[model samples]
Target: MQEIVSLNNRISQVIDNIKKVMIGKENVIVLSLTALLAEGHVLIEDVPGVGKTMLVRSLAKSLDCDFTRIQFTPDLLPSDVTGVSIYNPKEMAFEFRQGPIFGNVVLADEINRTSPKTQSALLEGMEEKSITTDGKTTALKRPFFVMATQNPIEYEGTYPLPEAQLDRFLLKINMGYPTMEEELEMLARTSQNHPIDTLDSVMTIDELLRTQEEVKAVYIDETVQQYIVNLIRESRKHPSIYLGVSPRGSIALMKAAKAYAYIKGRDFVLPDDVKYLAPFVMAHRIILHSEATYEGLTQLQVIEALIEDTYIPIRKEL
Candidate 1:
């Protein structure tokens, strides 16, 4: 019980640190932190200039982790993202130069603007946590998290992310335009100087790694586990859907729920946790049929329908 309280306080400190720079996006911040604690990547789709890059920077600062930003473009190559080997005249041997991908928190800005080939370069590292080049595999640092952003309003030259790549992201979120009051606060805060310039690290990398271990230890009941599986299975059977979520999606949802439960100061997961996280975790993984698209159906609507139709498991006493 005391450990849970301590964990909550530590998480709160990091959250508050990020809030210094980011205004009126508490849910987005918590969801991003949930993905990090789950050891999963995030896909943020929204209009430009909504603090997508700032959020990543603030997170890296708050966690005291190495930060790298990759401004993805049409001409970006595989070698550019995962690094390349070069011949060293002094050593007379090929040496590998680490790319921006080799960081604790990597911001893949405008990811959809890049070519598909270059985009695929992230797959190996995102899934395996290591990049292989010239028959050599180098491990990435611990707590490696990728926060990728894409502009949804522009489609002129952007390449749509493949379903496989989308599935790799544990959550798909949008940082919508802020309220008038929030924007006013933002203007006042940035009038003097950017708050991010003075933002300090509230937590250490080692402490974050330890917290992740604790998240993994959060208890989940058998009934709740079955409920998660049932939800995934239902997505496959839904008539409005084309390609349903894969087993990997189920695992991602379960892991995300555990992390979210841990963040809420609970040692055990409840059905409500799964219910709240379903759309963000499962919606992107499924593909609606062409007919369904023509009928004006959206992914969120389909996910919500699934949630409404699915039975919520009764909470069991721990």
Candidate 2:
């Protein structure tokens, strides 16, 4: 219990530091951190110039670890995102050259703009935490995370991520436009220089790993586990959903809810925690019926409806 509280305090410190640069987006910031603590990748879908890159940059700066950014383009190849093997005559061997994917915090800016072949390059790293090249595999650094950003408004040149690729992410977040007051403050703060440029690292890699361990230690009641399963099962049978949440989605929700509970300074999971995160964790994994889309219905709305219909476990176990 004491350990959980200490970890929560440390996590709060990191979030507070990030807020210095990213203004008025506390929920987005929290979800990003939750995904990190859950040891999963994040996919941010939103319009451009709305701090998509800035949020990721701030997160990288707040961590005392090696950071790299890959500007994914249409011409980007698999070797470019991962690494390459070059034959060196002097050494009489093929030396492997590491790419930007080797960093602790990697920002894949405009990920969808790249080709599917290039996007597939990330699948191995995101899931296995290692890259295979030249018949040898190289593991990524500890606390490895991929913060991928995509522009939902622009699909002209972008390749929509396949179900398999999208399932690799633990959570998909959308950062909507800021309020008038928040934008005004943002303009004032950036009048001199960007805050991310001057941001400082608040936590070390070792500390982050310890917090992740604590997140794993968070307790989940049996009933809560059933609740999570029910939600996923309902998604499959739901009328609006053409493709339901997979087993991986069930695990992602359970893990994310544990992290959310940890963030709320609790050692045990709650029904409310699951409720709050269901839409975010399961939205992208679900494919709604065409008629539902035509009716202006969304996956999120369907998930919410399911939640309301599903029974919640009482808090006695906690």
Candidate 3:
């Protein structure tokens, strides 16, 4: 229990630093870092000017982790993302040249702008946390995370991510438009200087590893586990849904909820924690029916319907 509290404090310190640059949207910041500690990737889908790229940079800065940005575009190639093996004529040997993916925090800015092939290059890295080049495989550093961003408003030239690739991400989040007061404060603060430039590292790699270990130790009630499974099963049963949450989605929700509990400074899980994270964890994994699509309904709204329909487990005294 003491260990859990210590990790909670460590996570809080790191998040407080990131919020300095991100301004409002504390929930978004919490979800991003939770995914990180859960040892999973994140997909940020929002409109432009919402600070998607800035969020990635700020996270890397606050953790003192290695940061690399890959501006994916139509012209981007697979080798450009995963690097290539070059035969050095001077040494008469093939030397492995690494790519931007060799970092603790990789910012795949405008990921959907690239062709499918280029976008798929991230698949191996995100899933395996490693890359293969010329039949050679290399391991990425610990705490490796891919914080990818996409512009939801514009899809004219973008290649949509396939379900298989989408399933790899633990959670899908968005930095919604800030309130007027928050925006005004942002303008006042950044009038002469960007807040991120002055940000400092709040945690080390070892500290993060420790916190991740602590998250696994969080207690999940048996009823809560049943709630998670039934909620996922319900996604498949929804009348507007053609497809449902896969087994991978179920596991993602479980892991994310545990991390969410830790962030709330609790050693035991809660139904509310699982409920709060359900949409983001299952939204991208769900497939709606043609009729539902024609109605212009969103996956988020559908998940909300499921949440309302599902029975919330009553909390029992431990």
Candidate 4:
């Protein structure tokens, strides 16, 4: 019990620290941290100036981790992202130079603007946590997280992320426009200096890594596990979906649920956790049929329908 309380307090501290820079996006903040604890990547789709970069920067700062920002463009090369081997005349050897991808928190800004080939460079790093170049692989740093952002309003010259790339992201979220009051508060706060510049590290990278391991220990009931599987199975059978979520979706949800439970200071997961996270975790992974798209149906609507119709297991006592 004491350990749970301690964990909750530490998580709360990081959340609060991020909230200082991000005015009123606690839910987005929580979801991003959930991905971090789950050891999964995030895909943030939103309009410009919605604090996407700020959120990633604040997260890296709050955890005291190495932060790297890669402004992906059409000219971006695979070697530019994963690094390349350069010949060293003195040693008569080819030396591998690490790219911006080798950081604790890497923000792939405008990720969709790059070519598909350049975008795929992240596949190996996100999946294997290592970069293989010239038949040699280099392990990435611990707590390695990729928070990628794409502009949804503008689609010209942007390459849509392939399904393989989308599946690697555990959660797809957006930072919507803030309320008037929140915007006013933000204006007042930034009148003199930006809040992020003054932001302090509230959690260490070592502590974050330890918390991630602890999150995996959070117990999940067999009934809840079945519920997760059912949701994934239903997506495959849904008439609107062209390509349903893969098994990876189920695993991602279960892992996310455990991390969510841990963040809430609970040792066991509840059905409510799955219910709240379904859309964010599964929606982006599905592909709507051409007919369904023509009918004006959306992914979130389909996911919500599944949740509404799917049976919810009775809450099991911890």
Model 1's C-alpha root-mean-square deviation from the true structure amounts to 1.4
Q: Is candidate 1 or candidate 2 better by lDDT?
A: 1
TM-score of model 2 relative to the true fold?
0.96
Question: Which of the two, 3 or 4, has more lDDT?
Answer: 4
Off by over 4 Å in 4: 315-318
TM-score of 3: 0.96
Q: Across residues 1-318, which tens digit of lDDT does each residue of candidate 4 receive? A: 677679779899999999999999999999999999999999999988999999999999999999998999989999999998999999999999999999999999999999999999999999999999999889999989999999883577788999999999999998999999999999999999999998999888888888998888899988999899989999999989999999999999999998898888898999999999999999999999999989999899999998899997665677
Q: Which sections of candidate 3 miss by over 4 Å? A: 313-318
Residue-level lDDT tens digits of model 2 in 150-170: 988346788899888999999
Candidate 3, residue 269: Cα displacement in angstroms equals 0.8
My TM-score estimates for the predictions, one after another, are 0.98, 0.96, 0.96, 0.98
What lDDT does candidate 4 reach at residue 94?
Answer: 94
How far residue 297's Cα lies from its native spot in candidate 1, in Å, is 1.0
lDDT of 2 at 108: 94
Go through the candidates in order and give each one's C-alpha lDDT.
0.94, 0.91, 0.89, 0.93
Clashing pairs in 2: none
Candidate 1 off by > 4 Å: 315-318
Give the range of the ten consecutive residues with the poorest summed lDDT in model 2: 309-318
